[model samples]
Target: MGYIAFTIGFIVFFFVLAFLSTTFSIPADAMLPIGGLLLLVMIIAIAAYAALS
Candidate 1:
């Protein structure tokens, strides 16, 4: 029950942040690079977690 509530709240927060970003004048091409960087960070985090455990 607690985890479910937390998940809902986290999703709500994400959408709120996404709505706020809509007002910005960001370029579409920038997303590819940012997404790639985030993906790299995610991979590194998972690798480190696996190595530690």
Candidate 2:
């Protein structure tokens, strides 16, 4: 279902971000920009989904 896929994608998104951060030793200062970008992407995704549904 769409709901289940969305939930899984949300979890996977965070997991991949965490893994990449740890693997690359991302700096704290960079996190703000990265988080902002992710937030923007999330908002766009939710809005698009809502419009489609």
Question: With candidate 1 superimposed using the best TM-score fit, by how many Å does residue 15's alpha carbon deviate from the native?
Answer: 7.6
Tens digits of lDDT, candidate 1, 1-53: 44554455556555644564566645657655655565566556556655666
Please give the TM-score that candidate 2 achieves against the real structure: 0.66
Clashes of 1: 0
RMSD of each: 6.1, 2.3
The C-alpha stretches of model 2 lying farther than 4 A from their native spots are 1-10
TM-score, each model? Answer: 0.51, 0.66
Give per-candidate clash totals: 0, 0
What value does the lDDT take at residue 19 in candidate 2? 80
Question: In candidate 2, where is summed lDDT lowest over 10 consecutive residues?
Answer: 1-10
Give one digit per residue, the lDDT tens place, for model 2 in 1-53.
55765787688778877887889999868877886788678767866886788
Q: Give the runs in model 1 whose Cα sits over 4 Å from its true position.
A: 1-25
Candidate 2 Cα deviation (angstroms), residue 12:
3.3
